[model samples]
Target: MSREPYRARWAGTDYEASADLVDGRLHLRLYGSAPADGFEKVAPGRFVRAVPAADCSAVWHVTTVCEWHGAPFLVHTAREAELLIEYTGGDALHAAGLGLERIERGVYRIWVKREEVSALSEKLVKIVSR
Candidate 1:
């Protein structure tokens, strides 16, 4: 069956957007306007939220993923990885070069150098998660 396309405009020209109902997600390409900070310009990911339109249609925003910016390194062992998973730091910690990708749990991986790698990861997680 045919579905109604969502309409939007970008760069001054008019455009259209469409979606497909897949196993567990909706996928689409879109051009549109949003609040100044409505979106981030990074690469896309799976998560999203729907905003209700006046007429009850939905607007989709690609959600951000959890990622710690491990400056200048990579996790080299299971013990280090385990340390990262168990760490969570807070405000006082942020100033110490630590943080977490709190939007969601980023079990992805970690990067680090010698000294305080786990401390850094824990501190960051607390700041963002809190």
Candidate 2:
């Protein structure tokens, strides 16, 4: 069966990210950095994908699992992804109740509440500004 594409949006802003799940994994392709107050481009990274622990690295085992619509999604789903975002400390949305939904084949949608987005954005700004 084919999976759907996924999209994620930050509340109160045009900032967003998109990815797809193929062969039981989600692929997040980072194009540009978000345009928040203190968002800094740490390093130039390319396409990264997330997959089930059985298929990917064993490190993914330590990540948390989030449940949405009775489905469990992995937080920091991928090792490389987790490190990349952690370096910048900007992708903390995963901890702020970010929700993901499969919209259609190879498509998925991620939603973050306005309040949480604001708080995350502020935290990122503080870190970057320092």
Candidate 3:
């Protein structure tokens, strides 16, 4: 599959970093200092740098599950995937939820939509700022 690169402004700098899929792996890199504020992806190939409110007590962020190795286990926290492993019946729903697209003997990725991430983050920020 053709993957696009994700870009975002480093935690506190104007410089941006690129997160790309290299050899079927997520490779995030920048030429300067590391992101101090940390970051999370809001969408596929899109990232957002966290901005903390004054005296913020907590930080809200989303995580991506690119690949997992659990031998018929693959839990993706991003997009819609499937579990391509061998499992017994009466638990199809439970097993399928273990994958993002298709899990086969463990190994895959996951990504959430931009709208969901943005909305969730916004809600958390409001609560934290209060």
| Candidate 3 deviant stretches above 4 angstroms | 1-15, 19-62, 65-93, 97-101, 108-130
**TM-scores, each model vs. reference:** 0.19, 0.18, 0.20
- Assess each prediction's global lDDT (C-alpha) against the native: 0.32, 0.29, 0.33
The model with the greater TM-score, 1 or 3, is 3
Ranking of all predicted structures according to lDDT, beginning with the best and ending with the worst: 3, 1, 2
| Candidate 2 C-alpha lDDT tens digits along 18-113 | 355667665432223433333445455322323222222211111233444333343332232231111122233443433334344433445432
Cand. 2 TM to true fold = 0.18
Tell me the tens digit of each residue's lDDT in model 1 across 32-118: 344222333323432222322222233322211222443322232434324232223333344244443333352223433334442
Deviation (Å) of 115 in candidate 3: 6.0
- Give the Å error, residue 12, model 2: 44
State in Å the error of residue 34, model 2: 28
- State the TM-score for model 1: 0.19
Q: Specify the highest-TM-score model's number.
A: 3
Model with the higher TM-score, candidate 2 or 3: 3
